[model samples]
Target: MRRDIGGVVRNSLLAGAALLAGCAGTVNAPYPPIRADLSPAALARGATIFHASCEACHRGGDAETVSGAPLRELPSYMGRFHASNLTSHPTAGIGSATDAELARAIRYAVSRDGRLMVMPSYGMGDADLAAVLGFMRSGHPLFAPDSRPAPRSEFSFIGGMGFRVITGNEPVERPASGIPVPPKAATREYGRYMAHDVYDCASCHTDGYSPRKTEGDDVFAGGMAFVDPEGRKVHSSNITFHETGLAHWTLEDFTRAVRDGIAPDGSVLRSPMPRFRGLDAVEAQALYDYLRSVPARDNEVKGARPRLTATSVRPAWVAATGAETTVQGTTVGAPPEGSATAPGHGPQQNNVASTTSQGPAGGTATAARPPSPGNASDGDGVTAPASPAAAQGSSVNTAAAPARKPRPAAPKVDAPKLFVQLGCASCHGPGARYQDRLAGVANRSEAELVRWVRNPEQFLPGTPMPTYAELIDEPTARALVRWVKAGGPASLSSTSR
Candidate 1:
């Protein structure tokens, strides 16, 4: 090969310049100039909003990955990924971010370098965004004093590289400032604000979120799937006023379901369902009103109950930790030894389980809040605290140690008759089959079935299926599981009314 010395030198210099440009690209630019209110009332409102919206994910929400770590260390995808800290700590949190920078992060998910952070762009009015910034500015760091880089896998950096290349790290365009907010009323306009900005109901209930998602799609026709800690699938119910949705539900029914986690059908919502007990009365009413106002889409989603029972399989990330730190899912760390649940915190709060589907025991459910609107640090996609009743269900097993020998098996029972009588067919309905829906049940021993039927929530912390202990005798429940595994002898005549 002939050496072109001058050409090589010229190319080297160009390469160096390119490298410098790349490095500079990662440096976040100063935020655009903007003024914001920092009044105490605004700050207090921000705090309340934080607790209602941001606290689930950032405040030690992921018990496995972010546990024992500072709140600044936000967890995403369980503990595998995380968002930048929002606390007012110069080193670890968004303390250095300018007010405009913070706004951009929330409204656009862009970093100082104009890099896209995995955040949702909330279509919030300016006042609401300003309040969030004010709250963040006044807030002190609650967890870590020093900042920590988010945990990463080998491909994480590569993924980031791809994102920057694709997005070009363009800063998010700011929305109009000083826009008027809807008055806190039960009117549809205010209800829209509460639903989209305050409680973020549409983000959870609908499909994918984008700048244009709200304008185009049928909002609140729920189809999101939330997996419980025990690996059961509970699809977000259709809240639209369609027959397959919440057409029959009253406003009172909606309130009880959101505030209490109890469905009108008498079933308890599974874990990861944050029963917003602290939701303001007005806000709750507004949300209900907004849901009713939206056009109903008849999306017939099923598996609104515990269907999957996974076998013991640990996650790959868990191998590094050794011990199987199961919380909601394959958690990487344990909660601080005396880490008590925050007062008024739901059962789903601080259950640091990982959401990854892989690892030693297939990735189990982990708790993390979804991103909040106009609040970059807030929101874990699966935000919802378990209800008080669901929380109590978790401790039932801890009180007693199990006997080594399994209990006596139940006698063979008729499943077809039992299924009809107990209304199992009601939710499972006509077309549903045990072969596809029922998981991990056929293999469970009679003793196991006895424990499960008696109190599924006790064994599986967030299962939505009500306990059958009261409905059926232990022997019958055991026999029922056995018969279900064998394939119910009688097929349903029609869908349960």
Candidate 2:
């Protein structure tokens, strides 16, 4: 009837020490060392990875001048989880952490002092890992010393106990040797690598990120739960190409949704889903290929997305080619506000409303820079300045971000093209179930129509029609609205083609 109190305490201490040892084991050989890359090229690649993956949390729309702000302050059952300072500042940032310590923190999900920090387990290859770590230490101005004060992560007692039980099984093993990156292609193999390894999409998409998920099974079927910084719990979408998932989402649709955070049905993605507008066309298509290749299960994630705080105002972060990022002070370039697509550029993909496309060009559709979201844009993602001036044309006052050149502009979105580009025709087009969707458009006032184009959610709270805020400016929306009001061009097929 008596408890072995001393023995229990001794055993608890031993267990804790063992777990801490496992957490710190990632710094040794076989796991790529932090000393591998500090060259400009390596740092650049690291910057790209950070922008595409880490920026959603770390950058959180903060301009470069703002001392690294406490990005997210999540209140979960696990306790207060604050996004830590990643800058080079000695105390308030990672400057005090050794390279090995940072690597352990990032890949092993263990802090320097060896406590659990609920970060996604990274499976980055040797080269990629080296680059990212190198960038963190490369003295880049964006990551320059920022002594921003931020709250430290503190886990609840229950949460800490749960983490010990759940993650106590040593983390997934790092590669014994460098895991080379797959070739960049739309092939299922590369796509699979990109989805799971590069983007770590599976980390959130897989329900609870269950460790024993079967590849090509329901792992990518979604339902992984997340609590936004505001404490709103939302389930990740079932992205497999199943009936309840993307269904017939074209590659283009997938791209638009991910890059711009707009859904095909016009619903905007919520916080925690960074519009990876930074992904280039090929990279995006690779993800699409991977998703389509996976097994699809029916798991509908139904709920209103929690509103965002630090997203939407995305300043550039090691820019790739999403519509919202900037390079140095330049916008990567868009047309003047409310202006037509610039002369050399085709049509601005940013537009009034709709979803994505993976048309006849195969999954190789030209990458479209998203139109910067207007301040009034809806949803849980973006709140870019309304003016094209902030992010259009040859000059912009963007944050200090460096990058490879922007991708070529998307093809024009004239009335006929626009009609199909936004997936608008899919519902109202000839074969759709609702050709009458625009039946009364001719009677609506131009202002009302413009509003509809810019923000369909205002009219229909859960409409699948997304806003053109990140794709087109007001004028283009007005033009499209006028075109829709006029019954669309007679020559155009009601079909999206």
Candidate 3:
């Protein structure tokens, strides 16, 4: 009887083991299918959605960014992360994945292998999700065929646990069917969809992910800064239709700025401000309408640094001479030896950058105050004039001096600082180990440099470099071009390597 009992127990254990093995084999099988519409209209809609949402990261052209995981292995975070090429190429792409598998990946961030994916769920509408699937099946492939499996993530055990805890495997519920996006008319409603859902403009423009917060009305207030490859700091402009925001920008101005990269004043926009290839005039108009409709905030944004001019020298002179006097309309003292200025060209009247409230007419223009003698003596750099005697007998070259011919205004921009601020040095300067140093760029002509910055794609089609046609004014762009032509950050060093 005891021998019979042992045999039964052994058989039970073997049967349990076999069941577990069978369950393990199903881990990579396609998940249950979700209803997906694959009509031509859906595919077309998907193409536009992909361009606005996924192409920026997954298009396998420009260097991959961290925000959108590249569909192919590319440089990121001192290493590399990759997303599968969602194309019809066998072995190298997701052509082999079943509709069920693709749907699961999009809906729940669950891969075919049952591992959690890092792709963010953008709360896609049901039609949008279906459209994306259709697009993957029929759209043109971006990368060449390769059979290697997408690399496994190097996430730590703790990280895996945290991700599982926070983002559970529950699939996102699809919106009710047939609720497609409204017509692409230049209406405020469509504009809202394009801005908040498709382009994610608020993601970059606002201070952090405030859109997801309860106090999310701060969207488009614009406090974000993008450090360019050169180390230039590019602050996002406030798009709110307020005095401190886009109060001066008309719909046409916004359209031109986004599409042509030409600002209202005809300045060049800095890099990382990519031109949306497929964002058409209609879409741009719609976006503009939506921006106008949003709540206006009075957040003042610091845009590109003011371009260097003759007037830019006043603050430095005041600090250096340390003595103030009313020497007529001239700079109180000679610039310290080896300064960039010529003999008599003193700080002009409008040397101090200031903004005055002229109601809606001025539109919050940036204006500078001319450094005055009384204000100079008061140390605030602005005040009513003091007696001429107070100005004449000052320590910086006292007594009546000969009226020297005005020297040419010194270049006020520090090339190194400008190089970093313009983000040129970050990608092309001394520290850019992965890229070629810009020492040779100093050889390009000013016109060529300006042209390149204004529109690099015109010269090199499909190039990853961005255009600065709207982010920088002519003078600032000229200064930067001159610096690049003069060997950039390395020019400051005594020795060249």
Report, for every candidate in turn, its global Cα lDDT versus the true structure.
Answer: 0.51, 0.58, 0.51
Q: Candidate 2: how many backbone clashes?
A: 23
For all predicted structures, in order, the TM-scores are 0.49, 0.58, 0.50
Give the candidate number with the greatest TM-score. 2
Highest-scoring model, lDDT: 2
lDDT of 2: 0.58
Model 3 regions lying over 4 Å from their true place: 1-51, 59-92, 103-110, 113-116, 123-135, 138-141, 148-150, 154-173, 204-215, 222-238, 243-245, 260-274, 298-426, 433-464, 467-497
TM-score of 3: 0.50
Winner by TM-score between candidate 3 and candidate 1? 3
lDDT of 3 by residue, 10-53 (tens): 88767655543332232232343445557989877776666545
lDDT of 2 at 61: 38
Q: What is the C-alpha RMSD of each candidate to the true structure, in Å?
A: 19.4, 16.7, 15.3
Candidate 1: worst-modelled 10 consecutive residues by lDDT: 64-73
